[model samples]
Target: AATEAALKDVGPIDLLVNNAACTKLQPFLEVTADQFDLLFNVNVKAVLHVSQMVAGGMKTRGSGGSIVNVSSQASQRALRDHTVYCSTKGALDMLTKVMALELGPHQIRVNSVNPTVVMTKMGRLGWSDPEKAQTMKSRIPLGRFAEEEDVVNSILFLLSEKSSMINGVALPVDGGHLAC
Candidate 1:
């Protein structure tokens, strides 16, 4: 695969960001087996595979590395019509914790960022309904959804030396959504 080939060419990877994800918003009863499989394959399996590859290289190099998985607030909060997506993210959060525990001895830190509804193009369309947006915003103490920069900054901090001692943390950039 292209990713494997690139890793091979570059040799040991010092930092890895597993950000690949996919989702389908549908009622739990309406989610088909195939839909579940696709979401799991992309969101969960891909992160496992990529992290294994890079972490192996990092271990071989005998140098510590940082891995940040971009998860979602849905992992912690139950959202309607997002059963499979929420499950995938929840699995990812657990994976981050386990990876951190196992890799800590090797000095490889693993963490995740749980961001609330970000105002990206997809987010704009997803929350286009003012009623829905307001309803969701009311729960956030910040009185707003997350910005792309907010998520990026959190991720960068987790990946940088600044978070060298931090591991197994699911940092939330959710404007206090988790508090509610």
Candidate 2:
């Protein structure tokens, strides 16, 4: 409702960034139905809902737009204890591709950014253990986890005219983590 009201007040939207997500870190065998539901609801369903709403307006306006889904490296790589989170992100990546294919005619481009551990508040706390941090960083050729700026820059590129030709791509901002 808030999003609908905002659209009414602000008029047609040219860009939609689906960045909402949730996670529950537990062994795959230990994950419960409720936990999986919660993660999927926030990480996948919310993006689908919001994008449908925004894309409708963009379509009607015929002005085309960009949709950037903030995914994670987990979408492309398996990680222990992140089964639910990883699954949701993988779903999101596929959704991005389908949306791109379906909406391309209307000039809507959809893409996702898959970043490794970013040093945000949550990221810092999650990987604060020196041993774990080092282990993760060693995997990245750049020898460091992503900074918020790195992800932001990639998003800006995808949303800007600079990336007009780019669509349905799960671009990694992981400092070469995916390369390895």
Candidate 3:
């Protein structure tokens, strides 16, 4: 329980960021049980583990804090071959809401930041093909995929006091991709 130990060592954690994820881009039939478990273990279970560990401290300390999970637009929009990935992120989105509801009384805010295609290493592999990239961009109202800065801004906002009153929300920083 490294997560719990870390919380105990720190005495009280003011923030938690559940950013782990795994994806196997294959057709539904090709996804094995092991692949499915791997995705859920990292994307869903890890979030629960870390949040539960830190949230208790924030509650007992009586000082409010923020918990931001990095979800994906796949939670709302389907991709061609991301069945397991999408499901795990969707689960994280729901968990953020439930955690927020449970922890609100203790002044622990739980929320999520969802981003569409970004220009990271992973995004390059997923969108480097010009035709595919264009098709993907077409679905976004902003007419472009997200940049790293776009996702960072969303996370920073959730962490800052500026979002103090905002809780249990899933903010999509997807360049309007979900709007389509």
Candidate 4:
């Protein structure tokens, strides 16, 4: 309800961006159910709740709108330490497709942007140590991490009319990391 109320000030929402995330890296045996629920609630449930709120207006308008969810390469490419994170994003990726199909008739487009190792502030914290950074860098086929601009361009494309017919898809902003 708070999420919806916050959007009330924005009036009608033409674009909805679901970009929340949480991660806990631990050995399979070390993970607690509580940790799992925390990530799921923040990463998944919150997205649905917000999307539904804005989507109603989009549907009623009967013209069109766009929903862009930020998923991750982890959704498809498994990292050794990312068990719960991968599962949560995988669910997000699936939700994008399901929502796309269900909302297509309303001209409400639903899609996802899946990035690999982006060098966002939070992302860099995970490998602030030079040795860890190098190790992480080696895994990216592009030989470098993703810049914010790289992701912004993809997102702008997806949000713009250029991607009018694109839906139910997970477009990779990964610089071909999955290919490597």
lDDT of 1: 0.92
lDDT over C-alpha atoms for residue 121 of model 3: 82
Tens-digit per-residue lDDT, 4-39, candidate 1: 876787766888888877777889889999999999
The residue-by-residue lDDT of candidate 2 on 1-180, one tens digit each, is: 876666677767898788887777899899999999999999998899889988998898899999999999999999888999999999999999999999999999999999999988878877888998899899999999999999999999999999999999999999999999
Task: Judge candidate 3 against the unseen true structure and give its global Cα lDDT, from 0 to 1.
Answer: 0.88
Model 3 TM-score relative to the real fold: 0.93
Once fitted onto the true fold, the runs of candidate 4 whose alpha carbons sit more than 4 angstroms away are: none
Model 3 clashing residue pairs (backbone): none
Q: Candidate 4 — which pairs collide?
A: none
Give Cα distance to truth, residue 167, candidate 3, Å: 1.0
Candidate 4 local lDDT, 72-145, one digit each (tens): 88899887767888898999999999999999999999999998777887687765778877776787777787
What is the lDDT for 7 in model 4?
Answer: 87
Q: Which stretches of candidate 3 lie over 4 Å from their true place?
A: 5-11
| Reference-based lDDT, each prediction | 0.92, 0.92, 0.88, 0.86
Model 2 residue 126 CA deviation (Å) reads 2.0
- Candidates sorted by lDDT, descending order? 2, 1, 3, 4
> TM-score of each candidate?
0.95, 0.96, 0.93, 0.94
Better of 3 and 4 by TM-score: 4
Candidate 2 residue-wise lDDT at 136: 88
Worst 10 residues of 3 by lDDT: 3-12
